[model samples]
Target: MKKSRYIILLPLFISLTIPVVFALTSKGQMLENFKRQEKEMIFESQTIFLDEGDRNILKTYNKLNVYSSIGDKIQSKREYLEVQNEKINSRVNSLESSIIQFDKDIEELVIEVNKINEQVVSTKDEIDTNKKTIDILQSRIEESTVILLEYIVYLYKKGDYVTTDNDIDNIKSILLSGEKIDELVNDLYFKSIIQLTGQQLIEKHRDFVSRLYVKKLELQESENQLKTLRKQGILERNILDDKRSSKQRILEITKGQEELYQKYISEQLELERDIKVKELKEQIKLNNTKKKLLEKYNCEFVDIQVQQTEFSALDEQCANINKIIFAESRLSGIPLENNPLDWPVNPSLGISSYFNDTGYQRLFGTDHDAIDIMIPMRTEIRAPMDGYVVFIQPVVNTGYAYFAVKHSDGLVSLYGHVNQIDVKLYDFVKKGDVIGLTGGEYGTNGAGLLSTGPHLHFVVYDEEEYNDPLNYLNLSYLSYKSLPSKYQFKYKSDFKSRKGFEYADTSKKQSTSGSTFVIEGENELERQKYLLGTYAVGDFRNWDIWVEESIAGGIDPTFMMCVGLAETSLGKYLKSAYNIGNVGNNDRGDTKDFPNARSAIAAMTSTFNNKYLGKYNTINQLSRYGNKTGAIYASSDFNWHNNITKCMSHVKGEYIPDDYNYRISIK
Candidate 1:
């Protein structure tokens, strides 16, 4: 019985110890997992190792996918725009035809109206002549009536004269002797016959006058009807002309809109193609080694599906990383220098994400170690300082490409998401040397597993620990408006007044003045060149030559430089080498090349003098788009004139502003 009791107790003790052991094991596993997760949170690319065949397959697949997708989009968009443009062309043709017809109809109507007017004038003249003739006939009729009355009175008086008392016996004697009485009454009888004939003539004249009056009334009525028809024809012609003008105006507006839309689409597509093609080329370069290795090993392509893992604890650890970076900044002996480094990218493109951004951590599930610079994909990446490339990791399918440079004075810079690197390991680079092309496209080659978009991930290390890049770069060139409110307050003292032009103020100087084209003194010219960034490189380096040549060619030196900036960003990146002005000879295929940049400048001045001088001499005149000269100069871009003139104003140093959006593209 004692043995049975001991056995039951042993089972209960085993049950109690089993749960405790299990709980302890679980706690140890959780602690290990937390440590592994913390290690994965940092941007470490050392663990990503791929076989030769798999790397080639991924590189090729990514290239094909990116190019095919972009190509398809371009083709579809171009087709859609073409279809719309065709419709607009057809409408314009129809309107043009209708306008021609309207003009012809209006001309014909004017002729018809003129003919009707002539007929009305002739009818009026005839009415006037008829009135004059009727007045003459009425006067003759009155004269004849008065003479007839006088003759009647004279005959009555003759009868009274023969009634004397003695006449009775004498008249009886005369009647007995009738042959002698004929002489006495003959004169009276003749006068009375003349009067009767005159009265008959007057009656005929009155009838003729009545007929003339009726004809005059008919002529006047016909003239009034013809005048009404002339007015109607004019009204109809005016209405037709108005419709033609309205339609013509609409056609012009539609054509202009079509050009602008086509240009916008072309620019957007061109930018995308440029980025993808460049990325593909760089990938090909990177895969050359893998291709050789694959052939040597005769390795088959292996498909591996990588699962993305997430750890909620990583965010808290990243916050601690930020603290470590801040502590390093304080421990370092190096103080902030005044503009120690040139901007890696264009200053016009402001920063997108700041270093140690809290908002970035909340959205991305990790703290950002570096600043993400805003720029288009495939933009040139320049070294911030003279340094030697120490480390380079070209990204594969699940890894990001980045390169680190060991700069002087214990400072190190790592440029991340670089698809194309011009420098290799241990290669020395200058401060402004183009090291590689930028890459951060989602799912594209060299874009890491956690990339949000296309941007430069720039990180600076102060004594081997991560720090802010802004500590080295000049903050004065940056715009206050682009910074966050907190940053604005923090860097308020660093903001300086720039001498460049301001876009907000309209009262600034214009390009019309002759002084606008000349940078007054030598010192002023250098200052403007430095401000515009043209003094650093290219043909503008020989600024004295530019000024002398411009003056010889009858163009202003300042305006010429501004045009160069507008066309090619001061020859920083040109579409065609040595074609500084981008002047075309009306042939799209005509790519003219000058021997040197100075020669190209000379060619530009010559072209302007010979082709465009007398006609489009002024900036305002050249800006009249759709005019003879404006369309020839820049048909694709409507803002060409505004851009050039704005550059000119900036160069003259007339726009001194307290604050400006320095990131805006003045070109």
Candidate 2:
């Protein structure tokens, strides 16, 4: 029984032990499978599949299968991948070439745009110049047309048909061809003949012939009178010869009588000598009286000499005293050494009327000797030339006043109707001195009667006679020479005048402030700040602040602000954007709809950057963060990077951040 139990137990133990051994072997195989899978996965992750055909085909397969299943596919894939990589490389090269070509085309387009802009500006300038030329031409043409029409009308009125036809033809040519017309009216052919019609011209010619015939008849009558006078003169000459013969006979008869009288006179002289000797003795008695008379005469002569010597000494002393008085008077401003009258008034004064034959006399019958100046009341009257004040007093009968200034050149300036007398008679006055004001008691109506409306009835005369003041004054003489024949007359007016146009008051007001409003003081600063704020947002249309500042500082604010805009874009970056306070690069992102505050700042800052930093260094570095990509982009960082050293060099005492990473963050 024991032997049978031992055999069964042994067999059971052997069975269990065999099953355990198989389970251990299965576990070992599972661990090996996991290890192999892990190794494959890691290998697949690291390696790249190469292919020649359809370069993207390897990308579609599992990395493990790509290595295991690769046979002809592997060789073909390798060849295909080699061919594809070559084609891809070629395509990349072509795209690179196309991009380069595109860049070149863009540069050329920019140049072409600039050229077109230049052409546009040139065309605009040319158009403006053409417009100005056209305006000038139009004005000239209009003036010519009016003149031509006037000439045509004059010819028609004058009834000069032939001259009118010639003028009209010329005008028609000018109008049709737009040709230039002569400026000289005298040169025009029809100027003189255009005043009469054809029939009128014929009548005038007949009248001229009749006048010539009458003049010839008068000349014949005068010749006959001369012949009759010659006959009378011959008869008178014969009568005078007969009288001369009678006179010669009388002279021969009287010659012997004079000789007889001479002999009788010789005997009478001897008798007279004897009588004269007795008379001489009697005259001796009176000699003493004659001697006394001679003595008295000598005494009278001596007294006369003494008196003459005393008179000479007294005269010399008087002259010396007079000279001393004159010197003292000049120093004291008492007596004017020289005539103080300033330059003559109305030197350049416009002429209203001239000394013409028109019976229009200011002093009634006296002809108007000088031209009238059509000036307003209180017009500053000055002496035309250097002169001395001869007389300054009122007129005799007339209430009008006048002042006479005698010039060194034998000319006199007479001012009449003065209302005030600033300088006394004989007071020295220089040219341009305010002698008197105009229009005080003289009303406008009286002013017209006294003179022609507050005018300085300026009269120039050489010898107190009527001479053309217009010629001496270098004034227009058209009105003076156009006087009528019957009105020609001359008269002398008084030079002394105290009341005239020269006396009118012309004091000006002290201030001239009007109704216009003006801001002053601290309000100006507020205005400037307001302007700066307004300009920061780009709304700088109104130029009030600029105008005010320009007026204050005396500078053109428009030009200065334009320069600043070119420099800092009107301080836009110096301030802050509405969206992103004062932070720099705050609005940087790819979101198209988001606010590009940083871009605006960058654009403004870039201008300053280009000015401060060199194009090759800092600007090129900044281009990396921009849209362009190239070797230039690859060499620089994407963050805000600039040549701080270069920037600081350009602007001394200006701080440039060393840490570029935080620069954009810190405002």
RMSD of each candidate relative to the true structure: 42.2, 62.3
lDDT of 1: 0.54
lDDT per residue, candidate 2, 1-667, as tens digits?
5554221111101111221111212323432343243223222321112123322222222222222233323344445544554454345435545545555655665555555555555545555554455455445545544655555445545655555566666656655675433222222422344434433433333233333333333344444444544454444444444444434433432444334444444555554555455445434533443334334333221122235564334443232222222221222111122222333454344555556423233224335556566556666666555444555543323234556665433455666556555664434455577766444235532132235455666666665454666444322222222322112111101111212222221343221122111222222233334434444444333334333222222222332233233223344543334221122322354222213432333232233223432133333343344324543322234322233222221222223333222111000
- Candidate 1 differs from the real structure by a C-alpha RMSD in angstroms, to one decimal, of 42.2
Model 1 lDDT at residue 220: 51
Please give the clash total of every predicted structure, in order: 0, 47
Clashing pairs in 1: none
lDDT of each candidate versus the true structure: 0.54, 0.38
Q: Model 1 compared with the native: what TM-score? A: 0.27
Give stretches of model 2 more than 4 Å off: 1-343, 346-349, 356-359, 394-398, 440-449, 476-667
Instruction: Give candidate 1 misplaced runs (Cα > 4 Å).
Output: 1-337, 489-667
